[model samples]
Target: MTSDQLVAAPETALPTLRGAVAGLPSYVPGRRGTGADIAALASNESHYDPLPAAVAAVAEAAGRMNRYPDMAAVELRERLARHLGVTAEEVAVGPGSVGVLQQIITGLCDAGDEVVFAWRSFEAYPILVELAGARPVRVPLDDSEGHDLEAMAAAVTDRTKVLLLCTPNNPTGVPISHGRLEAFLQSVRSDILVVIDEAYVEYADAGSGPDSLALYRRYPNVCILRTFSKAYGLAGLRVGYAITTAAIADGLRRTALPFAVSALAQKAAIASLDAGEEMEARVSAVKQERARMAAELAAQGWTLQPSQGNFLWIRADDALLARLVDAFDHAGILVRAYPGDGVRITVADPASNNRVLRLLEAHAA
Candidate 1:
């Protein structure tokens, strides 16, 4: 058609999202509670103030805000490398563990490549995979509300490029045991990258989850993904990292959005690492509270999996989920509810924990 004719015709279409992005489910963040009386326990963030050192570092770093962040995040990556007993070349930093995860997917997978992980785990897994134009193969959780490793292994095929193992998996809060995970690793193809997502590692008891660092040392294909957002209480700052083979880490760094992590975030994360002892003390308190709450919940006749994360998961069918959702809403308490699955309530301070206990006491089976 002539230019005039084409201009005269109504536009048939506008710029559009890729089909993969358009067809994907929207990520639904937990509802935030704004009022004083409201108990905000939905997001599983550490319900504590940022560490003193971290706060101070952020204040110091703020003066440098006019400058661009170090594009390579060399300082932060080096610090993380030293902390994890790896070389700087083997570390990659990003906006969050989820952001690093995005880099991982895009760097490794081509269109139609497959990524396998357990269902009912981190909600972001499939989203990131699909966004990279990769197929997400979800293996159903076992009867105990944890990864079905055998099923996940069985699901793997020639096209599979990655496997994600979320220790102390989100929402359900079940961790993969070291022995089982090691066996699973041996069964899987050597070429596939296995990402051990340890976002809640600090909250887990010493031996509860896979020793991911050790696993990474043994398997070059293994990648360890972690965040400062959980027990370190740096959710708003948005920084996380990955420890992988130098080759893969370099590829992830190359794929990362430029200066995605800020100077303030880098400083705060380094400070948090330096204040490990103080952070450990806070984590110990949360562990005690978790134990107390678990005992009380069990006494109330509610069956729950022992959670290694800083949150408790109560498996509920549709009816019970609806009832709990309504109750929490009316009580001005926010908890994450997964339709057809269950509810995840973050372990916070004593008063908030008591509030949750009282509410659940009334609804126990």
Candidate 2:
């Protein structure tokens, strides 16, 4: 029988699929260029090229493609542990921080549990929760477009299995205060896991954000998710990790897709760790550029949050945002626009930033 005809037969029992599995939506990555010569800034990525050391490491590791990667990811885990001042057992490396997140959800949450997170955060939280057959309880951000910690804590209930926290939050660029974070953690039940997604932690200024890793030490249920994708300029490498108690790390390691992290990626990440001087210099440049972009936008009467991350969140009506996006697209410049009042622009290189600013000015005029 033909493949199409066989599927049409009612007597054949269809392959069973979980309700959640069949309904799961695919994750959308940040916009990448399909056309030639587009200055894309939709995703908040580092402007500089990958470090020479990382490149060399990846190249060297390419020769070993015949063998499977270390399932335990021992050396990489050790390096990360040393970098974070944690034991190797407390660190779990995966394809990316998102993998670590998936592992955690699979290991800790069962069907019908609830996951609490602030709306307009990483966009992935709710989707991932739903894929796990868990309900996503979203708490709206405060007037400042930051997480409403008190409201989020209050949202916690007996059914809440996990609380996803994003500081210097994505798209909004607001950080939760150390005091507020501590209070929120204390208020939540000890059994509930708190996943602090700190993907942009390197770009966050020292004074504004809380020390989530320290909190992880105090709270056994807390997991700190970090990535090499942002400031490390390894977005293409797909390397990230999680830090938590040994038990949680063990669970993540057990459930994670084996060898999801390529050998080259692991080597490149280890090399990136040693490129601290270069990374710090790039971060400084990004901070300066971010400040300039926010000021330029504000001068044009656009409202912007005091961005702590490497991007600025500007507020404008939906129509205005659409017009700006269209103008930018026509001018070969790309930025992020949400359905609501949020528009995000990352601080790219000086030339790209200048071009983007000129496009915005023309559109505004």
Candidate 3:
């Protein structure tokens, strides 16, 4: 074997990780492209440029980079609390929605505890659970490509400490209805933490998704996770937060890394909230594009689920998917595809959206 070849270290040489991270699947982000014309639709990021207010806030805060941010994120949390009609103590801000989720898992779980969530939802669920030294129990999606809530409720056992529900679920882009969610919560144990992950809520229609704040009010265990990264075009700044009961929020904050939310991120997020009207206009544009793409794809004899998020899903089999992926790759457009699953194309500018439609049209030909 060469010097670089793998060899097990002697017991005395060094310690190894308990879970041995080698087993964990890597989280693949949306692919990026170097070509100026290449549309980046793989990540569910907003295609719009950052809002003027957010840009100004970031620029102003950039000057204060020399100092550490307020570790507790006092002003940001207070502002979010007022906006969301919750107490400051009920909010926990972190690096991103995923980071805040890590803090949540750490706060709620002990070693070998179980965390249940739908399979093929957010890819991070299992990774975060395992990192917390807990087990991830995956309940697969139903035939409609939506969460099998009844099955999920059945999967719960005494060891289950956390249950995640992703509205406008990642990859598939389906939202769980408010009535369905309320019923599911009623069936589950009160102590089990039900996380309502609304990362794409801004894009979802008013009728489709759960009224999470009302859910949180009725069910104390229900926590709402929201992010500035999606609709606000602040993905680069990485600001996300959790709204929950004061007790749970306190635990989440305790496990967070100090100064994880930078001054720049806090400023940008506050500005994004203040510029809600501008953000709404941008989101409306994305929705219109999504509708147009969905209609055109259907017209081309393609089948896709009704999506409420900022992406379109085509559940292609592996063979066709491979061909489609190659076409997109050669065409210099980036889109997210899961082997043996489907493809998710973010609704972007007309140029990018047209690229996707043309690629599909070529495949059809």
lDDT of 2 by residue, 13-94 (tens): 7799888778877766667787767888898888789989999999899998899988888999999988889999999988
TM-score ranking, high to low: 1, 3, 2
lDDT of 3 by residue, 126-210 (tens): 9989888899999999998999999999999999999999998998998999999999999999999999999999999888889
Give the C-alpha lDDT of model 2.
0.87
How well does candidate 3 score on lDDT at residue 16?
Answer: 64
> Which candidate gets the maximum TM-score versus the true structure?
1
Candidate 2 segments exceeding 4 Å error: 1-17, 34-36, 363-365
Q: What tens-digit string does per-residue lDDT give for candidate 1 at 294-351?
A: 9999999999899999999999999999999999999999999999999999999999
Order by lDDT, highest first: 1, 3, 2
lDDT assessment of candidate 3: 0.92
* Cα misplacement distance, residue 274 of candidate 1 (Å): 0.4
Where in model 1 is the C-alpha error above 4 Å? 1-9
TM-score of predicted model 1? 0.97
Using all chains and alpha carbons, the TM-scores for the candidates as numbered come to: 0.97, 0.94, 0.95
